[model samples]
Each structure stands twice: as structure tokens, then as C-alpha cells.
Target: QQQVRQSPQSLTVWEGGTTVLTCSYEDSTFNYFPWYQQFPGEGPALLISILSVSDKKEDGRFTTFFNKREKKLSLHIIDSQPGDSATYFCAASMSNYNVLYFGSGTKLTVEP
Candidate 1:
């Protein structure tokens, strides 16, 4: 199956807390790893990404830690804020560069 499964479709965190989202894939050929973030009534944007060759990627408050050997990955948001409250989708692809398998998305609300 070409499905990338994610858990806890929603998460609530404090403004100064940390949030974690998880994802797993069944595609053995998957190569591209991308994390998209979205806000209310907006399109998803590429927050951070890592090639299958890399295991971790960090960009400021957002970080993606991947385990290619285990077919699993996670996105961590440090010092989450109300502005960070949105949907996080973990996606995977096999170099298709067009069709990306996206998780259902986790809705995170950071309380201030």
C-alpha cells in the first residue's frame, strides 16, 4: 500500500512546550521526505525536508528526525507558540516529484 500513516490527528501544547508528530510508511522505495505546515484556510508550505539519505533535519523551531532503517519518522516543534498552531503533515515519495503521499495531518494548537 502507498500509504503514509500518522497518529494523533490533533495535538494541544503550551506556548513554551514541545510537540511531536509521528509518521510511518509502507513504501520500501520511498526516497523523498518532506514536512508541510498549514494554517487555517491556507495551503501547506514546505517547512523542512530531508532526503532519504539523511536521518535528521532541523530548521529553527522545526525539526524532522527520520529513521530510514525503521520506516518511521517524526516532526518536533520546540517552544511551540500560538502562531505554530496549525496542521502538520508528514509526506513521503519515491522520487516521483509530483505525487506525494501525505498523512491525515496533525492539528496542533499552542496555548498562550
Candidate 2:
């Protein structure tokens, strides 16, 4: 009942375009939200994320829109660029201190 599914194994965009990534889960009990961004051969870093109680979260050029009732969420990359090219993973947990169950991740590439 605690599974997160991601889509678009990979995607490409322009240097200054937009990129959208998605994630879905079955468990509504999972409240913690943490999106991680990973570069090639590197570990993921904590990106912007939203709690189940909130509808949105943003940091810099990244944003996360969450729909708790739907058990779904998405990440929108504004002004996507080559530096933003990385693997984005969606994860959830019951609490911030708990371990997060991460999605396989969506590979995004922004060409200049």
C-alpha cells in the first residue's frame, strides 16, 4: 500500500523550456514529501517538495504540485536548462524522520 510510481523513463527539452515529471502512490497515509534530483553517477539531492497537507512547494526553478485527494503529484521545471538535466525521483513517507520510498526516477535532459 506504499508504492510510488514514476513515468517517462526519460525526456529531453530545450535549454530554456519546461519539463514536467510525475509520480503517483497508493497510500494516502504517507504524508512526508521529498523529491530528489540526481546527476549522472551522483547521489540525489533534496529538491523542492510538498507535504500532503499542502498543495504546492517551490525552490528556485523547481516546483512541486501535489494533490493529496488524488494521491498524485508532479514536478515542474521552469526555465529548464542543461544544468537542470538530471534524474528526478519522487518519494514519500509517513513522517520527515522516516525513510522515504523513492520512485525509479525520470531522466531529464535539457539541450542548449
Candidate 3:
């Protein structure tokens, strides 16, 4: 069974627009939420993360929000550019372990 579920398998956005990606998890034990960005040939890199204790986290133009009660999380990209076009994966993990449960990912395209 899939522990984490992500919506909108693919997405398209115009340059300088906002991009929103969401995900939900079945496990309530998940404490750490991380969003990863991957290019065509490169590995996924940690973009931003938030702990269950916090409601939101922001890094530059990227922000991640977590709802512990609802077991839902979202990643928001403001002023999205062509360089931000990539596959984004939402993952959940416990605070004590390194294991991660990842969603299928959302393919994002930023049209210039």
C-alpha cells in the first residue's frame, strides 16, 4: 500500500507564476516532511523541509506547509522560473529513522 499520495501527476505553469504541489500521507507517525527537486539526469536534491511541530517553512521562493492533524502537506513555489521546472517528490519520515516514504512525484514544466 502506498503510504504517501501526491496529486496532479503533471503540471504546467507560466514563468513568474506560482506553483503549488500537494501530498497526503496515511501514517501519523511521520514527523519530518521533505520536498525534493530532481532534474532530468541529476539526483533529487533537498529543496525544503518542515517538521511536524512547525506549520510552515520558507526558503527563498520555496515554502512547505505541514498539517499534522490532517496528515497533509504542500509545497509552494513563488515566482517560479524555467530553472525551477523539475520533478518534485514529497516524502515523509520519522524523526528517529532515515527511511523515507515518497510520493510518485509531480512533473512540473515552467513555460518561458
Candidate 4:
């Protein structure tokens, strides 16, 4: 069973636009959420994250929103650039554990 579910397997966004990737989880025990960004031939890197207690978090062009009540979360990238083209993954984990459950990922293409 997939614990985390991500939508829109692929997405295309124009430069300077905003790209949104969303995910939902079945586990209410998940206390930490992180969104990872990966480029071709490279490992995924932590882009941004939010804890269960936080409703939203922001870092430069990236932002993450958590909705614990709905068991959902979303990552937003503003001013999307060509370099931002990559696979975005949403992951969840319990605060006490190091294990992470990842979604299928959303491949974002930023068109210049």
C-alpha cells in the first residue's frame, strides 16, 4: 500500500511562473515532511520542509504547506526557472525515526 500519494505525475510550467506539487498521506503519525528536488544523474536534495506543527514554511523561491487535518501537503516554486526543472518528491517520516516514505514524485519541466 502506498502511504504517500502525489498527483500529476508530470507537469510543465513556463518560466517565471509558479509550479505546485501536492501530496497526501494515509499515516496520521507522520510528523515531519520534506520535499526533495533531483536533477538528472544526481541524488535528490532537500529543497524545503515543514513539520506537522507548522502550517507553512518558506525559503526564497520555495515554500511548503502542511495540512495535518487533511493529511496533505504541497510544495510551491515561484518564479520557476529552467534550472528548476527536476523531479520533486514528497516524503514523510516520524520525528522519532529516520525512515522516510516517499511518493511517486512529480516531474516538473520548466520551459524557457
Q: Scored by CA lDDT, what does every candidate get?
A: 0.90, 0.89, 0.95, 0.95
Winner of 2 and 3 under lDDT: 3
Angstrom error at residue 51, model 2 = 0.7
TM-score of each: 0.94, 0.93, 0.98, 0.98
TM-score, prediction 2 = 0.93
The regions of model 2 sitting more than 4 angstroms off are none
State the TM-score for model 1: 0.94
Query: All predictions: root-mean-square deviation over Cα?
Result: 1.2, 1.5, 0.6, 0.5
- The list of candidate 1 runs beyond 4 A from truth reads none
lDDT of 4: 0.95
| Per-residue C-alpha lDDT of model 3 across residues 1-112, encoded as one tens digit per residue | 9999997899999999999999999988899999999999999999999999999999999999988888899999999999999999999999999999999999999999
Model 2 lDDT-worst window of ten: 91-100
Candidate 4 structure quality by residue, lDDT tens digits, 1-112:
9989998899999999999999999988999999999999999999988999999999999999999889999999999999999999999999999999999999999999
